[model samples]
Target: MSVLSAAKKVFYLPIMIGEWDMATIVETVAAMRVLVAEARQAGKSIGFVPTMGALHAGHLALMQQAKKNCDIVVVSIFVNPTQFGPNEDFTAYPRTWAEDLAVCRSAGVDAVFHPPARELYPDGWGTWVEVTGVTDKLCGRSRPTHFRGVATVVTKLFNIVQPDQAFFGQKDAQQVIVLRKMVRDLNMVPEIVMVPIVRDEDGLAKSSRNAYLSSEQRQAALVLSQGLAKAREMAAAGEQEPAAIREAVLSHIQSAPQANVDYVELYSFPDLAEIAVLNQDVLLAVAVRFGATRLIDNIILTPSRT
Candidate 1:
């Protein structure tokens, strides 16, 4: 099937063609499916970016990357409760619907799936999708139930939208790994596209939860990135031992008065196996808590042999 060009204009009559400001926003699964079906019938390639509300530059960059590849782009803004732990910030998570829609519109998103939790979960929801191995480390060790919730909601969204491709940011490195494993193991069809993490001028990863940071807490959050950079530098300088690299990261994070180090781990890429030597490409991940707020950052690095 020939794919429609990203620049090609389509008309539905009464509505103007080739307009980003006219992006459609739908809240129901039924409506979202109808729109996806119509796009497919038109020979348009669909790109999906699923996210919780409170749009940020990172989310917008993902949408922009989607628009560059697919003729029709769909973004979901559901703040999934299942992904949060009992004492976690499910109730406190930011949800800026109007601003999110504006960001989507500006990015030329064809549809916005802003479904309510009741509509998606309803009652008696029992089944969930989980990928093993990859989820057993990194963020999973700390937030045990997190990836289960993520996989379930992502599977539901994929089923509901059935897009040609899905976009995800690399900031959530383990998440991308788990979702990729889920797609392969479950035989799902949507092409998984991993976009690089967009960061602030000071190198802090852009996250919705960053809003919770006080001025001091915000400064303290930099320790996550700092620790990751230090570990990467050590790997480049021929530091092959995992224990030494981890210690470097922990010490830097612990130096910050407001920061509490969560975990500093090194693992082989994709496989996520713990590594002792810096002989190949690996993932360096760190998490730090700034008072009540928790922040995470990671970098994929290739060890520099001396």
Candidate 2:
């Protein structure tokens, strides 16, 4: 066996030795493949969590959930360029490789698949995957090609990682739904798991982009969460129209001077379709700009029996 393969064997031995305490951290695709092979040899099930580095508590929550369900947990930390538009902050996106490694290590991630962009998508990469309808609302309306980029990269990741199950935070509710649809439509085999959104004590959804916020912008950004809260309150207290729920959310954000509304949408939860009445599972998704930083948040409301 090669030294890389040998190292993987040693790293994964604890898993087969009936010790679930061991976690492996790898930074390249080759290392991840070797680790996955070793885990498979050990008859261990695999779970995957993919992210664009700058790991936060929200990411840790996804990793923890994966740890609970799969014997081998793999996390990928590649800032996929295809997912970012030309005008977007791809250049400024946070990337703390060493810090992210430390975070993954502490989270008990079995292997970290940190592949370079070229390896994942070669120079001749012309093919792209697009999911219609779901990408037509909220951030999609603004980003246009954004969901296509997301779908293409995610499909590539799914092909490369081949995890038996994948974990995504519900904080990106539309993303979760888009991926689920992609897997189903394409007949991909991995089971997709959605974890609840992790938030700060003040209710702002934890995100890597939160670092871009200035002290004042950080405070202004809380309007996204507060707006969602207001929508939930209005919906629960006998507001049944979808427009009413959306208006409530918009009104709250409009109250904040720094919050520039990008979109405040009321759509069918997970389907991304517009809803006339607020019945069953519906998503209240919003995107707003505080200074130059764009942030998103959503709340899924089920109709109240009352």
Candidate 3:
């Protein structure tokens, strides 16, 4: 009901709390449930941040936001395989458990749940949670089954953590949209809190996939943010046609030698509906592949008319 002040030093570093041996890092759903129950019984509000391993600045920002609002902040570091396509980088995705835990500690997280895939999705796992409709566009078009996996695992995590608030970064805009819809449709209780994307000093959006980029590709990746900025400038200068705005972004990305763009388009905010005119606040989103790594970025366009 109310935000609680964080402890002077909150961490989960494989230490005992007392004779109880209260380990903050857990690997099993049963252990996680115990921690959640203990926190709730202690009258502490829980904040959940679901993420794959290889925590980054964006993730730290999410944890920081959570710390401000909840007395106990928990982060999950499971790389869900169902979210990745057949040829995608499921095997290659970074999984730095020690480094991730360190980051979580630095962010003052109260607990970390690093569940193995087998424990979460044992054999004969069939049921899934999917939020249809607006999912057919944006990142959904390229990786069709992505959101299905996202929704299912998130639903599971929500049930396990039962957090008072869940923290998420806006870099994954469509993901936030899908998960929020899933919560509403299923009548779940955890509040979805969307934080702004934390970017690098060079304007590139912070992402774990950035580790895959070569120096050249890293430099070229700037097209994503640069293009969005140019498009936003055009919208501010009375460019109301969605087609023109999309084209401006597309051209900028295509001109980069190391860049292979997937999509550059505008959609109605929150609903993700396709729009013909920029008559309302819209999301200017782009997905570009630099070498083998795919990166996504977006900016909300709220044009002011005189």
lDDT of 3 at 232: 82
Candidate 3 all-Cα RMSD: 4.3
- How many Å off is the CA of 304 in candidate 1? 1.3
Estimate the TM-score of every prediction. Answer: 0.91, 0.91, 0.92
Q: In terms of lDDT, which candidate is stronger, 2 or 3?
A: 3
**Candidate 1 local lDDT, 159-254, one digit each (tens):** 999988999999998999999999989999998999999999987999998999999889888878888888878877888888898888889888
Ranking 1 against 3 by TM-score, winner = 3
Candidate 2 stretches greater than 4 Å from native:
1-28
lDDT of 2 by residue, 16-37 (tens): 2233333354545555666666
Judged by whole-model lDDT over C-alpha atoms, candidate 3 comes out at: 0.86
Which wins on TM-score, candidate 2 or candidate 3?
A: 3
Task: State the lDDT of candidate 3 residue by residue for 46-70, as single tens digits.
Answer: 9999999899999999999999999
Worst 10 residues of 2 by lDDT: 13-22
Report the candidate with higher lDDT, 1 versus 3.
3
RMSD of each: 3.9, 4.1, 4.3
The prediction achieving the highest TM-score against the true structure is: 3
lDDT of each: 0.84, 0.82, 0.86
Off by over 4 Å in 1: 1-23
